[model samples]
Target: MNALLFIVCVIIWGSTWIGITFQVGHVEPVVAVAWRFSIAVVCIGLWMLATRRSFRMPAHMHVKALSVGLILYTLDYSFLYAAQQYIVSALLAVLSSSVIYFTVLFRRVFLNKPLRREVLVGATLGLLGIVLIFSPEFTQMTAQQGLVLGLLFALVSFVSAAIGNILSENMLDEGVPVMQMNFYAMGYGLFFMYGYGFMSGASFTYPDHLEFTLALLYLALFGSVLAFGAYMKLLQRIGSDKSTYVVLVYPIVALGLSTLFEGYQWTLAAVFGVILVLIGNAIAMGKLNRQLKIS
Candidate 1:
């Protein structure tokens, strides 16, 4: 079940980059984010109501859940969308993978948990692999001020994502069910997105294009709801240190899909990158040592 959840998140979230591509031209990204979470929140809320799951929570828990949603769904996504305007998604994918290390560092700071050496080493290799995989894209880039802004946005987005991951673990530890927490958090995230949109004077430009609408729905349902649900469940089973290695993996999937649909040519470096990421995952999961002993 844990492995299944991890794979679900990896594939679904990886594919979501395509959906986000559609979201770019239709509306201001802030408005698009608002729409995405609003759809997720409503759909999830209706499901809970129909299934007779209680929405009632202690006031303090609601606050906690909302804050998690705000950071994870709102701030992380807001900055993430903004970053893409300045940099290619390949670069963003590589940058966002830093969430693994961020989560590791934050866990030690917030939970006072000893750092896991295996996870860090694995993450390091995975990060290196990603850079290699995207080396062609990186070399094609010319330096500009917008690149700096993109990097800054990506950093903030990833940090917010790492914080959200830890907070979700803490929330799960508090005994809130995963779906319910997701429901509330998405709800709060939608609120924040909407509030930010208005405050920033972002006009809510709704595109009537079928592709845009389809992409938005996909992002709301599969990307936000299904992927996130699976991910949070995986986080419960594996520690964040290990679970977030999915970040390294999902981008590979993204590139693979791009190869099919967008004619992305894979280089030899990309092949090595994939191998390293797989080996890193094995090391992190302790599979490498076991296999070595068996051999």
Candidate 2:
């Protein structure tokens, strides 16, 4: 079940970059994100109602849920959407994986979890892979201030997401159902983004093409609903330290898509980097050459 959830999440989120790409010119990034989450909230809410899931939140938990929602959806996504304007999607995808390290840091600092040496090694190799992936962009860094800023914003977004994941994991430990938590969190996040859109004078113009429309739906449904649902489930089952490794795998999926659709050339460096990434993930998972030894 965990493997299935992980694969589903990777495939769905991997394809979401195409959807996000189509959203480039239609409306303000935050406004588009707000609409996506708004639709997601409604869809998930209806499903919850149909399933007869309880909507009640404990007094202490509501605040934490809202706080996590704001950081995860509103703040992180706002920066991400804005950063896409300046950076290549592939670079952003790679940089986003750094969340694994931040998740580890938060775990060690607040949760008193020990930082496994394997995780640190994985993080180092993964970061090196990101550098290789974005080496061309970095060459032009002096001329591309916006790109530099975009990378910074992407890192900021990553940190916010990592923090939110840890918080959500804690909440789940306290007995919160993932779906119910998402519904309320998404609702609050939608409101937060809506307010930001209004303040920024973002327009509500819809895209004209069917491609964009379908992409928007895909992002709202599969990306936001299914992917996030699976992710939160993994967080609950495996804990944040392991769950954050999903971020590491997502770039590989994104790179595959880029190769297929965007004609992205995979050089020798990219292949080596990918190997490092896979090895890093294996090391972090502590599954390096280990088979199930049943007595």
Candidate 3:
């Protein structure tokens, strides 16, 4: 069941970048993200009501959840979309995979948990893979100030995401159920995102084609609803450290889809990078076997 959920998340989230790309010309990124969450909130709320699930959260934790969601969903995604305007989508995708390293660092500093050596090694290899994937983009960054700014924003997005993960994991530890927490968090995130869009004078524009609307629906339902819900559930069940291996696989899936639909060229560097990423994840998870001898 967990493996199935993990694969579902990878596939849905892998496709989310394509859907988001489709949304770019119609509405401002912030506005699109706000709409996505608004739709998801309504759908999830209805489901909770129909299923007779409790919506109550402890009064004290409400603020925390809202803050995390604002940082994670609202700000992180906003920066990511904006960054895409300046950077290649493939480069952005690779940089986003660095979230696992940030997750480990944040866990150590804020939570006082010791970083595992295996996680550090995995993070190093994963970062190297990202560097190789985005080598051309890095050269562009040195030439263009806007590109540099975009990279900075992307890093900020990763930091906020790590903060959100830490906060969510802590909340889970405090006995907050994933569904209830997501309900409140997403509601708050939507509110903040919409508020920001309005304050920024972003006009909500709609595309004339049914394809755009269908893409939005896919992001709201499959990406936001099913993927996020499944991921949070997995975090609760397997713990955040193990659950985060999903990040390692997501880019591979995204790259594969790009190859199929976007005619991305297969290269030796990419293949080698993928091998390192997979091996690194395996090592991090302690799945590598060691020989033992008994006297």
- Highest TM-score model number: 1
lDDT of each: 0.86, 0.82, 0.79
Off by over 4 Å in 1: 289-295
How would you encode candidate 3's per-residue C-alpha lDDT over 150-246 as one tens digit per residue?
Answer: 8988998888888888888888888998778888889999888988998999998666878778888999999988998998887777656556667
Q: Which ten residues in a row have the lowest lDDT in candidate 2?
A: 286-295
The stretch of ten residues in a row with the least summed lDDT in candidate 3 is 286-295
lDDT, residue 141, model 3:
50
TM-score of 2: 0.91
Q: What is the alpha-carbon RMSD of candidate 1 to the true structure?
A: 2.1
Record all residue pairs in model 3 with backbone atoms less than 3 Å apart, i.e. clashing. Answer: none
Clashing pairs in 1: none
Q: Point out the higher-scoring one by lDDT: 1 or 2.
A: 1
Q: 205 in model 1: Cα distance from truth in Å? A: 2.6
lDDT-based ranking: 1, 2, 3
- CA shift at 75, candidate 1, in angstroms? 0.5
TM-score, candidate 1, is: 0.95
Of 2 and 3, the candidate ahead on TM-score is 2
lDDT of 2 by residue, 160-206 (tens): 99889888888899899999989988898887898888887888777
